[model samples]
Target: MAQRLLLRRFVSVTLRGSSGPVGSRSSARLPRLSSLSWHGTGPPSHHRAGPTAARGFCVSHASGGIFNVQDQADFTDRVINNEKPVLVDFHATWCAPCRVLGPRLEKMVAKQQGKIVMAKVDIDDHTDLALEYKVTVVPTVIAVKDGDIVDRFVGVKSEDDLEVFIKKLI
Candidate 1:
């Protein structure tokens, strides 16, 4: 089945770290998936000029951070379509709690490599998404099961609490 294949790919990508369409790197050295940001100067030459703020999300890899999709379409294809459950952090650039939770979530991503896919959305930049999900607070975490939000937590949660929540899901 497609789900089984996706699950296998997810496990392979996590464990072997060398099998996905995307190149692999040790989870330790890689920037947390959600830590990828683009606050730098003008757009790269490859891209046409545009409002810098409107540019898509950027994902930082070992080689360099590259532009990633900022829309829900791409996110669904890359994340929700995958077989593994996903943990999405809805955050904002200026929120203090979001900043505090960012790195912690990254650390969790590294530790739980194969088990879950961690993604982040900057609620400030993606207001529609935040509104659709009814995420009124910064640092709102939602767990997606088979592409549907099945669990959610607001505010900062300890690693133990997160772990316990995730364990219950699996």
Candidate 2:
């Protein structure tokens, strides 16, 4: 119950644009908190938060195809040496475009059903790998097969364009 109240207060202050600190008891006019339903306790079932609300941050690599490249050695072992063609997604957590394209790439890669895999490399974490690939911008995807770059692209591509790109690799 206490958690729900705190969440409500936080949301109220945030949505209301209160100038005071988040915990401050300001008298700003807060918008309706009806949209937020915690633990299936508030409003109708339709208005309740989804399962993701409780899980917090989770990156599921159970697909066996989508994985993160930890470092240069990990990259060489998993991406460069893998049996399947790997979509080396050069990205960073701070990159706005990378965030947008990451999920799209994951979705398209998932559709392949293990035919191909995605190797996500955070440019900030692995600077050497980024430099080796000559990645100056975020969200650069390289299709690599047998340790050779087959094709590559920079920035976000439309769903249709992504699909076409992935299909061409296979």
Candidate 1, 30: how far from true, in Å? 38
Could you tell me which 10 consecutive residues in candidate 1 have the lowest summed lDDT? 45-54
Provide the clashing-pair count of each candidate structure.
Answer: 0, 0
Per residue, candidate 1 scores C-alpha lDDT tens digits across 5-89 of: 3543454345334322222343433322212222334324332212222344467433211123377886777557857777778
- Model 2 over residues 36-100: C-alpha lDDT tens digits? 42322333422323222331122539988998876688899998898889999998665789889
Using TM-score as the measure, the top candidate is 2
Q: How much lDDT does each candidate structure score?
A: 0.61, 0.73
The whole-model C-alpha lDDT of candidate 2 against the native structure comes to 0.73
Off by over 4 Å in 1: 1-57, 60-69
Candidate 1: global Cα-lDDT? 0.61
TM-score against truth, every candidate: 0.62, 0.65
Q: Name the regions of candidate 2 deviating beyond 4 angstroms.
A: 1-60
